[model samples]
Target chain A: MKPPKTDSSDFILSVQNLNAWYHTTQVLQEISFDIQRHKVTALIGPSGCGKSTLIRCFNRMNDFIATFKLAGQILLEGQDLYDPAIDPVEVRLRVGMVFQKQNPFPKSIYENVAYGPRISGIRRRHQLDAIVEESLKRAALWDEVKDKLKANAYTLSGGQQQRLCIARTLAVEPEVLLLDEPCSALDPIATAKIEELILKLKDDYTVVIVTHNMQQAARVSDFTAFFYLGELVEFWATDKIFTVPKDPQTEAYITGKFG
Target chain B: MNSTRQIKMRLIRQKWGDQVFQTIAVIGVLIALTTLAALLIDALSDGLPRIDWKFLTSFPSRKPAKAGIFSALVGSLYLITLTALIAVPVGVAAAIYLEEYTSQNSRINRIIEVNIANLAGVPSIIYGLLGLEVFVRAMRLERSLLAGALTLALLILPIIIISAREAIRTVPNSIREAAYALGATRWQTIQDHVLPMAFPGILTGIILSVSRAIGETAPLIAIGALTYVAFLPDGLRSPFTALPIQIYNWVSRPQKGFHTNAAAGIVILLALTLLLNALAIFLRNHYQKKHS
Candidate 1:
């Protein structure tokens, strides 16, 4: 591994000389980048370009895969996340994630949001109620679901279900949010709503999103990281990357000439 | 025009094959249902007259007309209760360990999975012999109710584990990941989410296995459960007799009255089994409707 980079306080996450593989097949090689605090960073690439894999490494979700192997330093708040003394569970609690598909539990809407706080030892009913209400409000879903908190989560529409999942993750009060193509399954109206929520969320939490839509990256992200074939092709301010990308491959991809 | 004629002919041949297979399948179903109906009719015709309040309450006697299944019925009930108490927890725990705690690709878990599948197919008589040696002799329980229950527990443990594993496996991995993302420990995830979701399925498996254990006689007989139990089993230590053992004994006798009594016993056993199966189906449907 290369010498550790100086990770300043402005950066909430920093990856240095990272290499990752699933068993014998390498998926990412020599990836290094720093994610700024309270800013939205979009990792954009075509399918099979390892963008998703790199995002998953933010909170160690890939630890569940038995064949996955990694050799690198992932620092969260200037502390090595992979240190033996640190538990992966703690890392996950501090860094929440929302999946591409809406995965609300087969429970009440209230219970779905309260689940995270409950597992963290918050048992008082009023306290949970407050957290659930606040989280749902922050996710921009309270106006529609406040009256039906007792209803089963499956009763909600596809877009509402996805926002409920966001509320569920937010109840844990994480400092960072990782979203893996969070709106790929939704229609344009729902996508616009979620994009608005992401912009609002960056005021309080650092956001790292993996999306294939170049327009989405340009609209929501402050910084855009372009990945191609397991390598970081280019990373810069979203405005500069779209208008004056230094790499010819990055320009070719953004222009829709070839993916 | 020639190619179109050939296609028409191929369609006709396909329809003929389909009709033939449908006919064979219908025949197969008819054969199974008719055989079952014939046995029930025969048993009801012979035994319906003998089944009364007096017959149900009376104890066995030397005279076949005075014999009843009071002791055997009670003993069978007691035996199954004990067996379920011993087997359900152990079986469900073993299933959870195999499904959740161990990685699916581990060599040890693979060996265990194959062994459990093979065990489910093993003859019940082998479990009887095992119980005879382990519980009856080595543990010094003798041919008592405890020994019989332990033997039957062994007989159905494999079935329970296999079914429980299937039930637990039905809970999607997405749910587990959701729980883990919230910082829930492995056991906490299983207890709060996995077990509750799998409860209906696990209950169905337990009931089915218990019903099988109730009908078991080879293992009970192998462990030396008495055939002429005159009194109800007082406790786990008391010697007992089951309905199958009593039915077997009466069927062997030359007297016609004993044959009628055996038929009555078979009817009762069949009713009990059907009732348990109906309960299992009812519970599964109830939960399915609630969830879906």
Candidate 2:
């Protein structure tokens, strides 16, 4: 592991010259970005614009697909993640992901939250209990779910399930959290709560979110990246990206000219 | 035509077709049930009186009029155990590999899959021939219990594999992703999440396949399983006769008593199959309720 540079502003992750493909079809092209520590960065784009693909690349989740391939250098705290010596499993632990759909395991609520910690070798009941409680609290779900920790996670509402998934990711104490359209499947109220949770989560974890809701990107993210046709069209402070984007495509998308 | 008249005509036509199809389907179901009921009634009427403990426990005698199915019953049990031991692991493992590890597009995997499907449809006697050549004569095991079990194992292996693959395939992809996201390795995900979720279905399939294996006579007969064994098989190496083989022998005999014994054996076989099927249903329902 490379030590953080003292002279530099802390960037938890940096992507350089990233290109990804599914078989012969290129899905991402030469994408580059920096994720600052303890801040929320939103990737905003239309569907099929590679937002999900970009987020999946952070933890190497694309490896599960048979045709998935990538050429890139992803640096985590100045360490090259794609190095042969670096395990994708270790990378995933450090960079946790919440999916678009609320997929809590069919297990109990406590088991769902404790799954990551358990797999990472935490076995004692008290230790697991603490991790589960702390993670649920961090995700703002503990109070709602505390009494029924033994209940099946699937019994929860969509919003609660999504939060449980978030808690599950948080239990492993990841440094960076990647969420790919986490609010898409949620109701408006659930979306609002999750957006608030995302904003709050940035105080402790570097959070990267992909959202189709432009107002959401403007409301929550400190910085925003706009993508089009698998390329990074523009990246700037959230206020600037919404108000005065340098790229015409970004302006057009935000103004609802075309997605 | 007026719009109302046109709409009425269309509705009548649709209703007529629906009624015709529904009636056809109902008739088909009734026919199947009637056949099953008739067969059960005939078997019971012929076999019920001869189902005394003596008939169930005694061995076949020199007189065709006094034969019993004890040796056959014990032989079937031994054959089932050996077949289960050999077939279950191999079949389920093949299913897991095909469903979880192999890509659908690979030529070699496709070839293997196609061959398995084809093998499932092949006559049971062909498997007996293979077993005869491979496990019995070539390996010099003779017409022993082991040979019969191996033949039955091969006869049922394809069905078990097909059913197990279906079971494993029914597990949601989301569950797999959830495990993977938790930093669980492929093998860990399969062992911890996938297998547990698929187990009830796999068990149901295995039980059904085993029931079919239990009633199989052609493969055993082809493998030269003795029909009139006077003693129970002591080991896999010993000569054996299964329920179907003994039933076949009794039914073939000219005496009325042996024919009655065959019917009694059929009743026992049917009862055992029904028990296994009930267990499968119970397991499936239990798992479904838990998961749901």
Worst lDDT run of 10 residues, candidate 1 chain B, spans B283-292
- Candidate 2's residue-wise lDDT over A169-189, tens digit each? 999898999998898898999
lDDT of 1 by residue, B158-239 (tens): 9999999999999988888788777777888899888888989999999999999999989988999999988999988999
Clashes of 2: 0
| DockQ of each model vs. true complex | 0.65, 0.67
Off by over 4 Å in 2: A1-8
In angstroms, what RMSD does candidate 2 have relative to the true structure? 2.6
How accurate locally, in lDDT, is each candidate? 0.90, 0.89
Residues B127-195, candidate 2, lDDT per residue (tens digit)? Answer: 989998988999999999998888888888999999999889888888888778778888888988888
Model 2 chain A poorest ten-residue lDDT run: A1-10
List residue ranges in candidate 1 displaced over 4 A.
Answer: A1-9, B1-4
Q: Is the docking of candidate 2 incorrect, acceptable, medium or high quality?
A: medium
Model 1 over residues A1-79: C-alpha lDDT tens digits?
Answer: 2211334448889988889999899999999988888989999988988999998888888988889999999999889
